[model samples]
Structure formats: C-alpha cells, structure tokens
Target chain A: MPAPQKHVIGLVFYPGMTSLDMVGPHQVFGALPGVELHRIWKTLAPITCDDGLVIVPDTTFSTCPPLDVICVGGGLEQRAVVDDPEVLDFFHKQGKTARFITSVCSGAEFLAKAGLLEGYRAATHWGMREQLMTNQGVEIVNERVVVDRNRITGGGVTAGIDFGLTVASILCGEETAKMIQLLLEYDPAPPFDAGSPEKAGPELVEKAIALMQQMSSLEFANPVR
Target chain B: MPAPQKHVIGLVFYPGMTSLDMVGPHQVFGALPGVELHRIWKTLAPITCDDGLVIVPDTTFSTCPPLDVICVGGGLEQRAVVDDPEVLDFFHKQGKTARFITSVCSGAEFLAKAGLLEGYRAATHWGMREQLMTNQGVEIVNERVVVDRNRITGGGVTAGIDFGLTVASILCGEETAKMIQLLLEYDPAPPFDAGSPEKAGPELVEKAIALMQQMSSLEFANPVR
Candidate 1:
C-alpha cells in the first residue's frame, strides 16, 4: 500500500541558470522512493541554460502543490531572478510553509533578496559570496555546503553534488543517501586544484571574477511570467 | 575573427541516458573558445532521461557536421541503444572519422556493440563491468578514466567530470582546461567514502549490483526514428 502521507520536492528553474547546479541535486532527490520531485518553472516551456543545453520544466509555479522542500540553482542569469518580483514572491510564499528552503550557488541570492535568508548563515557561489554578504544581510560561509536552520546553500557549480547528498541525508537518513552516493560514484578526483579562490590563487581568481562579471553583464531577457 | 578551423564535439543523447554523464563533459567542452558542442540524437525532440529529466538535442545525426569527438553517456537505457541498429550504424559511421571516441559509465557498450571498441582497453560502470568483459570483445580497465589510443572511457556516473577535463586538456592546453575547472568549481567533496565497490564493501556492492540489475530490466520506449 502507498504511504499515507507523501513528501514533495520542487526544484526551481529559469533561463540561463547553470544546469549542473539543478541536475546534480536532482540526481539525489529524484531517487527517493515515493517522493514527488517536480521541476518547477514559470511555465512548461523549454529553457536554455548558460551553455546552450535545453531543459524542460515538469510543472509550473502556479500549479505545483504545497512543497515540502523548494530548491533553486544559480548562474549568471540569477541577476534576472534577483530582479524578478514574481519569483521572489513565490519563494516567500513557499518559504512560510515549506519545511526547508535551499539553494545552490547564486540560487541563494533569490532567497536572500526575498528576505528569506535574513540573519541566516549560508553559503553561496564563492564569486558571489562577497556580494551576498555585503548586501543580503546574511552571514556567509565559504564551505561547500552550509545549513542554517532550514536554509541550506552550496558553493559554486560542482558543490551541488555535495549539497545534494547532504540534503538527501537529512530527508531520508544517512544510509539512503550513502547508497545513492555509491550509485552515482560520488568519489571525485579533480585533475586540477583550482575549484575555489583559495586554491586557484589570487591572480587566477581575479581573472575568473572579471570573466564572471563580463558574463553577468550580458542581459538575460527573462521577465517574470 | 574566428579560428581558421573549428573544434567540434558531439555528445549523443537518448531516452534513459544519464543526464549528468552528458552534462559534465558539456560543461568542460562548451567553455572552450571556437569549440562547437552539439547535443546530437536522431531528432531535435526532447528525450526523457532515466531520472525523468528532459533534454533536447541541438542537432540530428544526419544533419550534424563532422565531429572531432563524439561522446555518449550510459544508463539502463543504454541496453536499448545497443539493441538498436540505427544507433550502432551512426557510431560506426562517426567512429571512422572522429578523432576521439569516448563514453562514460556503461556507454562504452554502444561503441562495443558497434564493433568500434574491438581490442580496445576501456572502462565502464563497475556494476556492468563483468558483463561487458564476458561478452564484449574489449579488454577492461578498472579505473576512473582510461585512455587507449583514440578511445577514452570513464567509470560509473560521476567520473564524467574527470573524463571531461581530461578531454579538455587534450583539445585545449592545460592552462585553458584549468581555467575551465576553476569556473566549474571542479573540486568535489562527497560526504561518504562508499563510492567504489572496495570502498562500499562487498555486501553493499552486491546490493548495489542487484539494484542496478533490477533497474536495467525496464524497457525504454525509445524507438529510433
């Protein structure tokens, strides 16, 4: 027989968001038994990510049921999400009732802008951590994954896997998460040691920041639907 | 002005393929200058992955231009691909011209079925390694990333990232690949030590193999059109 109560997860998507930030966590969450995982967006249309990959949303913000967990991801396009009131409103409305509010990379910017992360210690994309600290009124952590109360945030693109496993452990216990980790072959062997600013050194980090700033300057025409 | 010659990388997608397998490499290759990354399948229609994620191919096999590299990802859906003649034909056709042929997880099965990996030493998902060895006429390499002449293969799901960076270093210089590595925050920190069969212990490995076998039995309705 089906479980009497069901758990639901809603992952938010928008144009230009880093696809890995979303899909990494999805590989963990979607594997849970009897858990309803919904890829939510403004509409059901296919959205193009920063690198030209196309992803289709499974549901819309308006039609999705009350979510147990709401997750968001970030990219250069997060600027548009920060400026969109409808998305902020959705986060706010959902934050009040959701058991956990989470983000990966700059995805936290939306929650922080929505005032959901006020006085909360969180993590963000290393490149964007300073910006979030300076303006978002939240204490920032530079670690891979940070969980303050129900607000969990992860560092840049690849941190999503760590973040996903952390979230999976919380929702379904350590054993289940460990099993998923093994299945995904979560052991990582980076051929380089430049994943973070501390490791990449100041010169390379500065170059990366400039590249990111240049990228963010490009306009994304994603309006609130 | 564009480079005199463009570098083309085509990653194949189909129903039930793992999304991360395709995307990890995409993140690396897509960042290179003058590099054209095409998500190719039989058509431009959306293909549902094993995890319910939908991906749209950028080009069709017939319309896709010549490729310097052709990549594939694997999952339970890969069995269907091995049984499809059209997909096998495409691999044989592309293998004749592509400078590099690659796969992640069980995706090597497609190339093996196409007779392209004959006498090649390759890697595949650990769970499916024995089957591949007993049947396919290819020597097996038990490692995260294996390179045998023009053929490169990665183990299991998450090895795609390392495989991607390896390929990136070959196409571009190490400096460029390292820069992309930093941009992607390629450093991974999985919270568990159970990523491999030895690490997860024999009991968990047996359980995992059973689960994988159960998963691979489901038929994917991905008719070659």
Candidate 2:
C-alpha cells in the first residue's frame, strides 16, 4: 500500500502585499492532512507586508515545485506586482498545470495580468474592480468567492477564509472542509454590518475610498459595482 | 504642535502558534495611524507557525518597548507555551502597564497561566474550555469577543478578526474602524453554518475534537459550556 500523495500548494508572496489575504488562506490550507504549503517568492528574502509585519518565504520561484494550488493575495502594491514580468512569468508558467489558480483581493489583478483569468469570471477587492475590469476578456464578478472552472477568486482580504474552505471542499471533501472550519472555530461574528459598500452607506464608502487612496497613489476611487 | 504618540502593540509569537490568530489582529492594528505593532518572541529568529508558515519577529522579550496592547494568539502548542517561564515572565512584566492585555483562543490560557486573567471574564477557543475553567479565579465566557475591563479575549482562531475590530474601535473610534473594515472588505460569508459546536452538531464536533487532539497530545475533549 502506498501513502497518500501530498498536495503541494504554493502561495505567492511579495513586498507590501496584505498579510491577512495570504495568511487567511494559508492557515486554512495548513490545516489539511498531507497538504504541503509553500510560501513562494521571487527570492528567499524576507517580505514585509503592507501592515509592517514581515514574513520569510520558504521557496523561491526558481525552486518552487509544480503545485496543486497556486494562490496570490492582494495589497496596495497590486499595480507594482502586475508590471513585474518575473512574477507574471512565474504565474504563467505555473498556471499551465496547477490544479487550481486562485487569488484573494487584488491578487486577481496579477492573475489577470498574467493572462490566466482571461475569459474567466472572477472576483477581487471592491476597490480594484474598476482597474481589474480593464483586462481584456475577463469578467469580474461582485461575489465573495467565485469559482469558474479551475480558477477560484475571493473578494478582498477576509474572503480568503471563505475561498480557502471552498477550495478545501473541492480538493478534499465537504466533510473535511467542514471539520477544518469547526477546528478553527470559524463561526464569524463581525461586530459591524458595514462589510460592503452598500452596507457601509455613502459616508463610509467615501471614507474607505479616501483611506485607500491615502494608502497609495493608486487611482482607486472605485464605486460599488 | 506635538506629534501624536504612537500606540505600541506587541503580539507574542511562539513556534507552532497559529499565524491567523496573530495576523488577523496585526493587520487591523497595522491599518491604524500612529500605531506600532511588534511581533515579539524570546529571540529574533524566524518562528514557524503550526501551519508551516514562517514569520520573522522584529522584537525580543528583552527589547520590546512599553506597549499599549499586548496580545497572545492560541495554537496546539498552548500547553507548552504556558509552561514556558520565559514567555510567562514577559507577559507578567508587560501586562503590568499595558493598557489592554488580550488573547484569542487558547491564548487565554497563557494569560491565565501568567496570573493576568484572575477574576476576569474572558473568551477562548471552544475546545479548551474544560482546561481553562480549571484556572483559578478566571471565568470563561462563551462569546466571540469578551471585554472585561482592560482584558479582552476572543473565542478560538477566526474570532481574532472580530476581536481586532473591537479593539480598533475602542482605540481609534468606530468611524476609523469602519473604514478599515471596508478596506479589508471584511464582510464574511461562510459557506457552511457549522462554525460552533452546537451549529456543527454532534458528529462534526467529535471529528473536530479528534482532529485537534491528533494535532498534539493535548487533553482537549472540552464540551461547550
């Protein structure tokens, strides 16, 4: 009798990316049995997340093995990552045979930029819809987690949890995913109902937009779609 | 005009600790202006989370500055951390003056072990309630987030997000916290309703407890209180 094959999941990391976006899904995937997670980067150096937390990547692009799951997480530096050919090429090369190519938040931008999301319906952080819509042949959906064939994209940072569970159910089984959710005690009770633009109203939407604009010089006055 | 004083937040990190438990709150605190978050540990070496993720700590126990917030996150290694005198001593010294001393999940056990949560109402991961209840002078509450005076605790792993937002609102006002929520798009949409033990039912609860026990040799057959 042979041992069960390991599920290798490579999560792309870059400087200024949202630590929560990647860490949320990473935590979820890490709970599965026989699953190996790789924090992949261009180099093996420490990557500082946008929130000042630092993460050390375990695998470089050159050393990352063929992955069952290739996931990208978003941050204010999405525009910068989109233009980096090295990252895009890595995505293009890995997307060819990965069982799942996924993203959370503006991470969808990198997949779209790499031409992986072309002709696929996807989701991203609300503030990034306007910019992501610019990619040809991509249809951005306003959903928490979108699963179009093998491409699964989550909306914004916190949605990574939902996206991860969805993927876990797909890779393992619904029973296993539900058990993982239970283990994490993932029953969420957000204190405020202002999670979305519609729920937050105009004042908060404006404030959120302004706050995002202040975070970076990106043209991010995206209206609720 | 004088500069606004920075809010120093120290999040304790130990090997095999849950990354999301720390990162969720870290991301929220990092979004605030005039806030400094320190990933603190016994040494400056990279700490590997239980899920195989590596995080680089910027501050050590000896060098961490006076903190406005001192938070500990839970993991399967909670018992080992509780017995670690170095970590408990750091918590004791820091808890003396920190405005808010907090924990998420079994992290409450460390605070309890350090004599910080004495006579305090707190929350913790649902699986550890039996053991945590044995801590003298501590009253465990079964809630998502518990705020008893200056001691705040969150239930289980994913509750860290709610706990983070609650602390953010308390520190920086609800308006600013709301904006941060919008930026993260924290609207959660869990695909399954099996988050809590009651909601997850008997079969899943047994599975979750078995899974947790398998992670370590901890005595964790805690029934919901």
Candidate 3:
C-alpha cells in the first residue's frame, strides 16, 4: 500500500518575526498526520526573532515546494516586510494557488501587501489593526481568528493556537482536530485578565502601546534584516 | 550609572521535545525588561522539535552561565532525557543556585528525576500524570499552573503561556506582566473544549491516547538521541 498524500504547509520566515506567532500554528499543523511543514525563508541561514530566539529555516524561496497552506507571522518589521518586493513576490507566487493563505498578528499586513486580503474581512493583532486598515479593500475585524473564503488571520501573538486549531479542523475533521487539541492540552487558564486593551484598562493599554514604541525604537534603529 | 542586573533564564532543549512547550514561556520571558533568555542544549546544533520546528540552542551545558530561572519543556524524549547522565548533571549544576526551577508539561518529569520536584506539589501534562507519580515524594497537581515554593510546573503545552505570565509577574511585577500579557494579546478563545480528557469525552480521549501511541511507536523505533 502507498503512503497517504501529504499536506504541505509553508510558514514564511523573516528576521524580527515573533516566535510565538509562528510556533503556535506550527505546533498545531505539524501534529497532523501526513502533514509536511516547511519553514521557508529567503535563505537557510538562521533567523533571529524579535525576542532573541533563533530559528533555522528548512526551505528557501528557490527550493520551496508547492504548499497547501502558506502562513506568515508578524513583528515590528511588518512595514519593512511589506515593502520587500522579494517577499511579496514569493507570497504572490505561492498564495495564488494555495488552498489557504494565513497570517498571525501583523502577518496580515504582509498578506495584504501581496494583495491577498483585498476585499477580504480579516483579523489581526489589535495593535496592528490601524496599520492593517491602511491597505485598501481589506476590512479588519477584531476577532481572535477570522476566516473568509481561504484567507485566515489570527489576532496578536497567542491567537495563533486558536487560528491553527481552526485551520486544522478545516483541513482534517473536527475529530482529528479535537484529538490534536487534547494532545496539546489546549485548555487555557490565564492568571491575569489583562489580555486586551479593554480588559487591561486605559493605563495598561497606554503602557503596552508605549512599550511597543520603545521596543521598536530601541531594537529597530537599524532593523536586522 | 550601572545597568540593572539581568534576570538570566535557561530553557533546556533536547531532540523530540515539543516546540510549543518551550516557545510559550520563552516568548513571555523574552518580552520582559532586563531578562536574558538562554536556549541551552548539549550542542550548538539545531534541535528539531517533535513538530518539525528547528531551533538552535544559544548556549551549551558546559558554557551556560548562572541562571536566575531554570526551565525544562516536555516531550516524548523525557524518559531518555531523564536517563542521560550528562543532562542530569547539567540540570543539577544549574538547579543548585537557580532562584527558580520550573517545568512545562512532561518537562516536570525531568526536574523530578533531577530531584528538583521532591516533596513539592507540581503540575504536568494530564497524560503524563500517572507516569510522573512514580517519582516518590512529588505531588502531581492537576492544575493549569502549579506553584510550590520556587518550583513551578505548567499543565501542558498551551499552559506554558499562563505559566510564563505567572512567572513574569513574580519576577517583575503585576503591572509589567500585565503589560506583557496585553502586548501578546493572550485572550484565548479555543474553538472546542476538548483540551482535557474530561472535556474531550471518553471516545475522543481514547483516540488521542491511541494517536500518541502510534506516534511514539512509529517515530521512536530507535528514538533520536
């Protein structure tokens, strides 16, 4: 008997991308049977994330295979990523025929730059909503995970788990997805209730925004990429 | 003026380990100010996680500096890792003066083997509870995150996020952790409630257990050391 056909997933890698945003979904998709995961970057050199975690890409643009799903994670470098023609071209080429074009956090901005989110309702990190809206024809929704047609976008860093599970259910079935969830022990019990701007209150929200500004300014005086 | 002292954190890495288990806490701690995160492994070679994600260790056992916190994430290789004398010695050396000793999921088993969890109430992946109990003097608490003295353990994969945040709050303060929480946008909304055996029902749990068995059998013919 022959082995089952594989579901190839390509997660785009760029310097400064948030590690959790990519890892959440990668863990989910990589758990599925007969699934192949490719960490695609322009080169195979190690990519240092925003938080200093270093991940090595498994595939490069020239060597990447056709993908059933193409995912991108977000970071402070979203604007720089959107401006990169090489990355945009890669997304355009792979996303044109991909069954699913997905993003986590400000990764939606990259998809939007590739014209994939045009006229599509999407979700993104709350902090990046205004920036994402700058891309015309995209209606930004403030949900944890938004799905419209084949475009799936998740909110902020931690929402990737929900987004990944949702996509897993779609790709496989609920039973399989549920089993994966159980294996992951996806039950969440946050110690604090300050996960969002509204829940975190005005003071915290202001501090969080300022924190992002500080990080971006300090770390990206010259973006690594 | 001298810079504030850095809180150095060491996350143990091994082949066959779950990526999410390590990535979750690493993301949270890495977001904090004056915190240095270390991915310590046996070598500088890239460690391929169970889900196929490749992460490069920033430090090695012999060269790793003193840590404020020592963390181990769980995986199928937990048993093998516990048996490896080098790893145990490394844990022992670092665990001696570390302010906090921690684990996520089955990673608790490693700490238990290192005698770090002796006589302490801890948490681990639900699936591994029975196995973890075999280690004498340790009380396995079935909570999302468990804190007993300086020993902290998280329930399972996704629980690492909550665990990380809790630790962050302790290391920094409520305000800083809250800001990190909001920055990560950790408002979790799982599509299904099948995260635990009770919520997943008997049939689903059986299937999950069987799936795990199949994976272990097929993937660990020799068990990648």
Give stretches of model 2 more than 4 Å off. Answer: A1-5, B1-5
Candidate 1 C-alpha lDDT tens digits along A141-180: 8788998888888888889989999988888877778878
How much lDDT does each candidate structure score? 0.82, 0.89, 0.87
List runs of model 3 lying over 4 Å from the truth.
Answer: A1-5, A217-225, B1-5, B217-225
Q: Which residue pairs collide in model 1, if any?
A: none
Q: State the displacement of the C-alpha of residue A79, model 2, in Å, after optimal TM-score superposition.
A: 2.4
- The TM-scores, chain A only, for the candidates as listed are 0.93, 0.96, 0.93
Q: Assess the local accuracy of residue B199 in candidate 3 as a C-alpha lDDT between 0 and 100.
A: 86
Candidate topping DockQ: 2
Instruction: Kindly list the per-residue Cα lDDT of model 2 for residues B125-156, writing each as its tens digit.
Output: 88888888887679987899999999999998
As a whole number from 0 to 100, the lDDT of residue B160 in candidate 3 is: 96
How many steric clashes between backbone atoms does each model show? 0, 0, 0
lDDT of 2 by residue, A1-225 (tens): 576467999999999899999999998899887898899998998998889889999899999999999999998766677788899899999999999999999899889988999999999988878878886678998899999999999998999999999999898889888888988889999888888887888888887888788887556655653
Ranking by TM-score: 2, 3, 1
Every candidate's fraction of true contacts kept comes to 0.70, 0.85, 0.89
Q: Write the per-residue lDDT of candidate 3 for residues B41-123, one digit (tens) a residue.
A: 99999998888889999899989999999999988655566679999998889889999999998888888888888899999
